[model samples]
Target: MLPEIITPIPGPRSRELAGKLRRHESQNVTYLAEDFPVFWQRAAGTNVWDADGNRYLDLTSAFGVSGLGHTNPQVRAALVAQSADLLHAMGDVHPTAVKTELCAQLSALTFERWGAGPGKVVLGNSGSDAIEAALKTSLLYTGNAGVIAFTGAYHGLGLGALSTVGIPFFREPFRTQLKEFATLLPYPFGPAGDMLRLRKELVATIQRRAIGCILVEPIQGRGGCVVPPAEFLPMLRTVCDEYGLLLVLDEIYTGFNRTGALFACEDSKVVPDIVCLGKALTGGFPLSACVGRADVMDAWPPSSGEALHTTTFLGNPLGCAMALAALAEHARPAVAAQVQASGQRLKSALEKMRSPHIWNVRGRGLMLGVELIKADGAPFTDLAIAIVTRALQDGLLLLADGPASNVLSITPPFSIDDEEIAFVAARLQEYLTALPGSIS
Candidate 1:
């Protein structure tokens, strides 16, 4: 229930395991640092115990995948039930009963509830898979190959998804392999006039390229949880409608009550033609869905005994069972309220710090960011990473993301208690206050 750091972080056992991993696994996969990358041995609720048995409060929710809480009882029970009856199945061909149920529930929760007809579902194993599915659907439905994405957006890293990924760091190495179908536009965060001008630029790009869809994240998660103005989504919706472009919302990070609302787009009252969902969809299981408007999704021709797009683990039964249980838990009214309250408490605590290094603390619900900057107004990337290191030593596990890696990403499970939130706030303030005058 609370953090208990028994030994120094990266304790003896973790160091040994990290050494083993460095020898056998790809070094590029996991950043192996002397004092970082603690291997998780167990996680429950808002806590994670490293291999060395050091317990720490999790603020990242394991990359926003455990919204309901790590190893939620209901989801675990569902996993157990599914494992006994069935485990894996032919996702695209001979589907399991739970998969069908999950697809229907996802449709009901999204498109159907949003005034669209029953939604069409394309299940996948990761967020990138879902994004690719949406991209493919857009291409087929609109008969256009090009897509419009935002600079600060992070859809995924798969080939199809990477084509539209906004981060140049991820795409640079694979540029030759990519199809060059994506055009990145500056994500808006300024004013009404800026958004209006963006609309004009969007129209110009649509006219110049074979643009079929516009892909974006409602609240840029990996992009420092940068939440645009209220007019941002509505402006995109207006332009998409006027130009016959499909609006594809990548809610992989902001979905499942992380944003107070079930989906961030709901607050804006803008219904995207297609939405990619993952991370917390199944608590801990690897499952994602690309749910689209019935009319838009139906653009794919019926299977002629063969599917156009699918994966070996497309709709694994275990994932479906857990997803069903997680969705049921999200249906409870307390989940949203808990998220909103917990977020406000954490945000308020951070704002009260008044540390000069603090630039901004903004986000909806549990998905919040604390931007760190130097007096010169440059992103404090080194200090942000240092803060993460210091926080870890103090029994708080967080991440610094965004282009400059200067924003502390604080997305905890909805079930986190006020005490844990207080612990995190106190630790953050301590770290910021201790910095030298030259930096602060």
Candidate 2:
């Protein structure tokens, strides 16, 4: 039971305030608009209400952060309980019970992959931090600084993570800092020639550069929810094995139940040397982790040696409790089954749509994308943006991504119901069919 919209998006008051905020704000990073930027008043379950009282279906899940739905009751309760006991504690110095509990649970979940070696967990405050941690772990383990990453792959925005990210636009400005340590590989998506060259180059790069690690996304999220070719990951694993390059899987977006598996590597049976997880890990709370083989993770020594990395809120107890609850909630067989079923229904509905602009629709489980195509079958970025804007006007929160940013990404909360899925599909169909310049 979602709430109803009572006014045009942003409303009069929201527009007025947005203007005032824009004056002092950077205005570049924040995507605020006078006509449409919905000011979120509150959220619960799969719906959110703007300041003007208009409710949204929450398709984007606040950038895929809310895994178990918005403001989950269990997580909220856990947060409150942990807060009452202790707000902040020295994580690396004096670990709390909740922090230890969370690490233990995560270890149990990853036991099949990490085994009982020195493989352990490193906590952080965000996805980029976790990614940076993984990057550091790789460097320390192999004692090499070089890294290989795929085109269109986004690891994080930090210096270390950015160095490994393959997107040029995001990193070009900081190229001086990233170029020396980074090597970009081709992302296997379209065209046979490009993919063939990419495969050959990847192996060559590993051998030539003496690469210490290869950072990859199980499924590229910001790169338009792009799913790689069936042979991509396994082949990369083979290359890593041959070169002794540590394989690091950035599951910040594809982890949790979003990909219908606890981890996306499960589909390909490709076990990475290091795994970086975030986004829904803490169920909307700010928590991230780098978990992997003990030898790789233990690159940093224990208290006997100085801590290489430390954060003011490293193993946040409140965040840990909420994460534990989130993990437990999604661990249920029933919840996992629901995500798989719903994702199939959503994908099927998209596949059935006939749009002259749609080039392709591909993804696994809840993380999916609809890529817009031109007449000659080239990727069309504008068309994707148009569809997203139209959907937003119709009360859906959507985004576009990829090298072109022409992918209409539909990664809603897994708790979204069947009716909501049908409604979203129907709305997009209507919008594209009626919109000006739409190919239909």
Candidate 3:
């Protein structure tokens, strides 16, 4: 009894709000269509209601932030309780009891999951902040400024993180201001990708440059949820070991049971020197962590009066409490199992469709993507847009991702039921089967 579309997609109120936003906000900040952006009023579990009272099944999970589902009762209660007790605290200078507790919990969880002995964590306000911390940690630990990053990588848009992003357009405008510290390499996708060549390239790059770290995503999320070969991460670990490079894994999207494991690196048994975690960390509240081996984290000297890399909201009480509650809920065995099952079900359904337009279907757990292609095997970007737009009209919220924006990113909340999954598949089939012979 979901996806009750009482009005046209985006409707009147949404368009009005969007128009107001266009007048006030920066043009570059809004990605959705100017005239047709859906303005959400409320959300619960896997359903979101737009301003026009149109209910839709939320598949993007609000850009994968609401992993525990929108307005999770436990996380909401924790946030409320923490706000009443203590909302703000002096960050880094005078830490609160909740901050201390959250740090301890994160450290213990990292150690237990990744097998890093006595892990240490540095909390930040967002994924970009966590990536910045990891980058600084790499520089401090190895005494080298050079970094090795992979193609299709998206650390963040901050100046430091943006420099490491793989997409050229994201870095083009600020090329002069950004440092040339990172060297980009191709991430292995399948058997066609040459591991030996990549290994040689990595070795040569390390030998030539003062490279200190190799930053990569276990499964490239924005790069269309591209999953590398089984041996890719393990081989990267080997390369890191041979060259004494710190391996920094950005798990901002793949972490917290999104990939059927607490962390995607767990599948390959590859423990990184530094791991960046965010997105679903606090179940929607802004919280992120840069966790690493104790020895590596000890590179920075003890703080005196002024800490070097501390933010004003380093460990907000509300974020800490909600993060603690979210982690406890996600760590449940049943949750992980359900994610695995849901991912399998969705993948199987997508595979069954097997349209000529689909170039590939890939991903693990709930972070899935469908790559669309033309007869000539070129990326069908317009078709992707049309499909997603159609899906929206049908009361299903979908997102497009990838360098070419031709992959349908199907990341739903872990709480999505089988019926919703079936509906999504059926709607996708209907749209794809009815694709016009030629899209402009």
Candidate 4:
């Protein structure tokens, strides 16, 4: 029921709106260049209808936020019901019943591996704040100021989270201030990086120096949806254990049945000390949490200790209530199994393309990537942009990421139907075929 492009994208109304928005926004980073910025009028399960009445199969899922689908009925009901009851509560000082219930669900779901008395949950408004909280927790637990992060991994943009950012372009502006806190390591991907050597280097760095923790993305999101080698996480776990450093896994993108498994870490049986979750955690609301081991979380006991971290909107009632519903949605075994099956189906379709512009298709679960290679076998940055632009024209919504922002990241909602997936793949093929170079 998609591909309803009655008018060219950015029809008169859309153009007018984009022009107005341009006045109040930075055009460089906002709109995709080729197509008109179709203003969204409404959205439903896996599809978005623009102001012009043109519909698009939402492949990116609003940057991985609406996992259960846009304005999901359950989430909307929870939001409406909670808002009507009691909206605000003092977060850490005074908590509500919904807040306590939400935390109980999160604790019950996560600490299944570690036979736990009680794991702690600290709430925040965004993924970045949750990550920043984890960083502080790590520092407190180990009583050290140093941390380790991998190349091409994106944790968040806050000072503490940004310090662990591996991309030079994102970190270069703030490097002068961030260098004193964290060390960067090569992520175990590609052909050349030796895991054993990297492991030894990490151990040496953490043991000799005052390293408190190592932050990693269980499945890199902003970094081209890269799924590092299978052994990579377990090796890091071993290194962290040996070095006495807490392992903080950022599951902002990989959690909530996005990665086929309950959490991507479960695939390898590696338990991290601290886990940061966001994006789809609250279905489609602004909620994030840093849940971890008790000893690590209890680093800041409330007796005259410098208030380690606190956000104004922490443990928001509406957000918590919505998250409770989202987690319940995640718990359904059907959701997890469907994500794995759909991911494989899409991956197989991409692999069958045989396009010369494609370098390779890599990733897991609903999160996948089509890495572009030039005719010379090097990365084709411009072509990737062109492909995305062309895909937009064909009524498909896809985006690019990675350090270069050259890889086509295909993260459709987990709830997409088979027909919708086929349409997306067909649109991609049409775009590739229209390019000048031969695909085969």
Candidate 5:
């Protein structure tokens, strides 16, 4: 379904909310502007209703978290049912049965499916939590402090995960707060031609530094949905094996059919030692899981009753139940194929048009990026921002992605129909066609 514009973009109600938010909330948190920041009242499927009653076709999927669509019925029902049964649980002590079941299902979905046996899980509240969990697990298992991560990669902003983050913009300011344990290598694109050189460097780095693991996003989400060559994961897996280092896949954004696979790494069949998952895990709940092979995760010593690493809401009942429901939906055999078909339709439409402002269109499934650029070939960061602002007025929500913020990212929900895909491409075409002359 296409978006319907009612009141002006942010309209009166959104402006009121923005003013209140600016006064009480951290100024650094949300960007405040007259024509921006629509306060979402409610969302469902692929549509979002704002405070001003404006309905927009969601292209962001709320930062790629609602892959099963916003407020999925089954997930919502499970969440409500779980709340009636148990509002909270002492995670480290007396955990809920929902958590137990969720963990078992996660093991079967991941390691068991890969023929790696059952996996152990560390539950968390956010994507960052999952990243940190994987980092800690890798450290515990390999007993090495150093980590290898690719440049242009984003693995969340938590302190432990921050050290391994490749975006200099995020890492530079907090460099002092972060441990000097991560080595950032350039992320490759195009063919696997230069992979040999990269492999040599990676091997040397592993030997020279006390590297515990190689952390990566199978399809770099925040990094402009950058899809590396098919050899990427296989290469990492081979090196990690040779050096006896863990291969940690941060599938937070690329998991749950976002990349037309249960996990993007599945396309390569490269089973990771640790997989950090979140975003679409519970469809709309604050939940995440860091799953690792049983043997690898067993590196952690048994809890001395007190539990060394535990959160108050480690396995929240509401989130766990929602996750169970989302998992069942994601397991549908047709989901991945449907996503792939939708992706091709959108990709083909975007590629058919030629514009000076368009640099490239790339990515898989619903996770795609239109690389906005200037006539001079430099990144059109300003143009991308302008497009997002303009698109919001058109009852379409979009986000500029990557460390440079020059990629117009499209991460719509799987529930988006063919008509919705056509609408997105049409809107994007208009933006692309109009931006060249505007860019300076």
Candidate 6:
């Protein structure tokens, strides 16, 4: 029962709030639109209501932050219970029982999935923090400052993580301030021949550089939900083993059943030396973890009064409790199956369209994308934006992502009903069919 457009998007109240926010909020952080941005008042499951009372079906899952869905009941209940008991604890100085239990669960899960042997975890408040910890771990363990990263990769926005980010626009502004410790390489995304060339290049770089780690996204998320060849990850594993380099998989976006597998790396049986997890880690709370093999994590010297890397909010009791609940909910076999089935259905529908505008439709499980193209096969960024904007007006929220911003990222909640999926597909088809310019 979505598409409840009671008023124009960003209605009067939203517009008023936007004007007020503009006066105080920094321009860099605001996602300003023409009239006003859609101000969310509340959300539940896969539906979000704006300040104007327009209920839209969220397709992007609030940038993949709410995998268990917005305001998930289980996570909310955990948050309430934890808040009533223990609200805050000094991170790194005094860890709470909840933090210990959460870490133990994560370690056990990592061991069971990757056979990494009772891995250890370092908690953080965001995905960028997780990446920072992973980077430091690599430096300490391998004693090499150089790290290998892939093109179109988005580790995070913090200085440490930004140093390794592959996106030019995201890194360009802070290039001079950031250290040049990462070597960016092309990600293999095409046929066997293309993958082989990329693999050769990667090997050559490893030989020439003092690389301590190879940091990568199992399936590129912000880079348009790009899914590399199935062999890509397995090849990376082989190369890492050959070069004695630690493999760091950033599963911040692809974890928590967003991909068909619990972790996209699991599909290839690739056990990374370090795994950075966040986004959906706490359902909707700010929590992240840098987990890895015990030996690697233990490389850092024991704290002699001053810990090297620790945050103020490192495993807040509420976040940890919510994370525990989220993990349990996401671990259900039914949840995983639903994601796989829904993704397959959506991808199949897009593939069947055979529209001239669609260059490709690819992704794994719920992390899907539709790459739009012009008649000449060039990326149609304008068309992609138009579709997304139009869908919003129709009460179907969407997002455009990719190097050229020509891919529609469709990452709905795992709990989204089949009817909602069908509605999204049908609406997309209708819009594409009725696009202003006819195919030449």
In TM-score terms, candidate 3 sits at 0.97
lDDT of 2 by residue, 68-144 (tens): 88998988888888889998898988889998988878777774444544458999999999989887888888988
As for candidate 6, its clashing pairs are none
Residue-level lDDT tens digits of model 3 in 175-231:
999999999999889646788889999999999999999999999998888999888
Give the residue spans of candidate 2 off by over 4 A: 113-118, 190-197
- In model 3, the Cα lDDT at residue 17 comes to 86
Each model's backbone clash number: 0, 3, 0, 0, 0, 0
Task: Record all residue pairs in model 1 with backbone atoms less than 3 Å apart, i.e. clashing.
Answer: none
- Model 5 clash pairs are none
lDDT of 5 at 207: 79
Model with the higher lDDT, candidate 3 or 6: 3
Determine which window of 10 residues in candidate 2 has minimal summed lDDT: 110-119
Query: How much is the lDDT of residue 95 in candidate 4?
Result: 70
User: What's the true lDDT of residue 152 in model 1?
Assistant: 76
lDDT of 5 by residue, 1-440 (tens): 68988888788999999999999999889999988899999999999999999999999999998888888899999989888889898988999888999999999999999999999999999989988888888888888988999999898888888888888999999888988889999898856548888899898898799999999988898988888988988999999888899999999999999989989998998999999999999988899999999999999899989876778999999999999999999999798988898888878887876677788899999999989778788888988898898899888899999888999999888878888877777877787667545535
Q: What is the clash count of model 2?
A: 3
Whole-model lDDT, candidate 6? Answer: 0.87
lDDT of 1 by residue, 1-440 (tens): 77898988889999999999999998789998989889899999999999989998999999999988888999999999889988889988998889999999999999888998899899999999999999999999999999999997899999989888887889999999999999999898633438777888898999999899999999999999998889999989999999899999999999989999899999999999999999999999889999999999999999998899988988999999999999998877788888888888888887887688888898999999999989899999988999898888877889998989999999998888888877788888888888454245
Per-candidate alpha-carbon RMSD to the true structure: 1.3, 2.0, 1.4, 2.1, 1.2, 1.4
lDDT of 1 at 293: 92
**Model 4, runs deviating above 4 Å:** 26-29, 32-36, 113-117, 190-193, 303-307, 436-440
What TM-score do all the candidates reach, one by one?
A: 0.98, 0.95, 0.97, 0.94, 0.98, 0.97
Task: Give per-residue CA lDDT, model 4, range 187-291, as digits (tens).
Answer: 876545487888888877866789988899978889887777778889888878877888899999898888898899998888888889999998777889999
Candidate 5 whole-model C-alpha lDDT, 0 to 1: 0.89
Q: Least accurate stretch of 10 residues (summed lDDT) in model 6?
A: 187-196
